[model samples]
Target: MHTTALVLFSGGQDSTTCLAQALSKYERVETLGFDYGQRHHIEMDTRRVVLANLRERFPQWAPHMGEDHVLTLAALQQLGGSSLTDEVAFAMQADGLPNTFVPGRNLLFLTLAGALAYRRGLQVIVTGVCETDFSGYPDCRDDTMKAMQIALSLGLERRLLIETPLMWIDKADTWALAHSLGGQALVDLIIEDTHTCYLGDRVHRNAWGYGCGTCPACELRQRGWARYSARDANASSSP
Candidate 1:
């Protein structure tokens, strides 16, 4: 029997890529999405829609894959300092941390994911956090994830493998992986349908992907899209 794994899903580019990666590796894979009082529910809604589509494509993906287990981290509202769960108006800092950084976000999410894994006898929890994309956010760093892994192991009293397949890869590589896993069809759907805008605006996005292009999230995404496009252009032109 293949070992079951749980994914820390968010229905965005990174997490969606991670989810697709999980689909390829594990015999059974369940997704864990949190309703942490976000400013908007578009991301969660996107998760539902994407998973539903995936189910149609891969019927064997999740009946025993915990289709009913999309957990909610509602308590994140109580522990808010970032703009995600707070009403505080955030100004775009030119150099320092952006207001989009949610304190203790990955930490809390990973802990809950670990507990869920332990309870369900699943040993792997996969997330798509990247140090290169969102380096401004301290939580996205490799050190932060390592620390959380240790903490979760101690708390759960069991060995758990927290998979970070996209941690070291950049957005361009992520797009490449998406293409490899689910083909250009899935990759196109992810690009056109997924939501990653920090301001929660998808309808008003440019060619670089969704989100307010001025925010840090959009900046990274837009740059990556450009880089990927250029790389593809060069590759096609090469002998």
Candidate 2:
């Protein structure tokens, strides 16, 4: 039986890395991207381009790269308090939780992914939610993922494995993981093509993906790239 996995891809650095890792491990890999009425809806465009690039560059994995699914949850915008779904400006620190923290976003995404996985007879679902170096999103934690896994399994009446490859790893480690999975090609794809910017400004390209350079997501990515580059430089200088 061929091992099949579904990836909850967002076309950002972390999810893109998770997708690459899935292609490396799974016999058949399908990706699901959400259109939750986010301000940075260009992420879907990036996802398409990334998938196309992967299929072209890594033809060996092309057979396993199953069809990609894009689901729209536009109602989340109607039910919005989050800066991501609302017209509110993105703010890093506002009160206890960040304004960008879309309530139940990850939960809904994972649940939907699980439903799709169960329907397709897939037992493994990969997500890129990271606890380490994460913003104040509560759903990105390991406990939440575990609980969601159990809920999905019980609800679907099928044992489901939720794979969080970037769960404990920080952004710098995420970069290293991408490099390990697909070498410089993957790394370059992430840097040059993937969209991680919350503001969706493709004009301000950097070592990291195109970002506005001020949002929390961009800050974390920039910091991670700086750390990763420094480490690489030091290693190159070493014996």
Q: Pick the candidate with the highest lDDT.
A: 2
Worst 10 residues of 2 by lDDT: 86-95
- Note the Cα lDDT for every prediction shown: 0.79, 0.89
The digit string of per-residue lDDT tens for model 1 on 1-239 reads: 44788988888888888888888888778889888888756888887877877767656555545643666777778877777777766665465887777778888888888988888888788998887766577888889888888888888788888888988789888888888888877777687778787678877857755677876667778888888889888999999
Candidate 2 per-residue lDDT over residues 1-239, each given as its tens digit? 33999999888899889988888888989999999889999998988899999899878778889978989998788898888877777766656788899888899999899989988878799999988898868999999999998999898888999999988889999999999989999899999889988888899878776989998789999999999999999999999
Candidate 2 global CA lDDT score: 0.89
The list of candidate 1 runs beyond 4 A from truth reads 58-68, 87-95
What local lDDT does model 2 show for residue 94?
50
TM-score, structure 2 vs. true: 0.96
Candidate 2 off by > 4 Å = 92-95
Model 1 clash number: 0
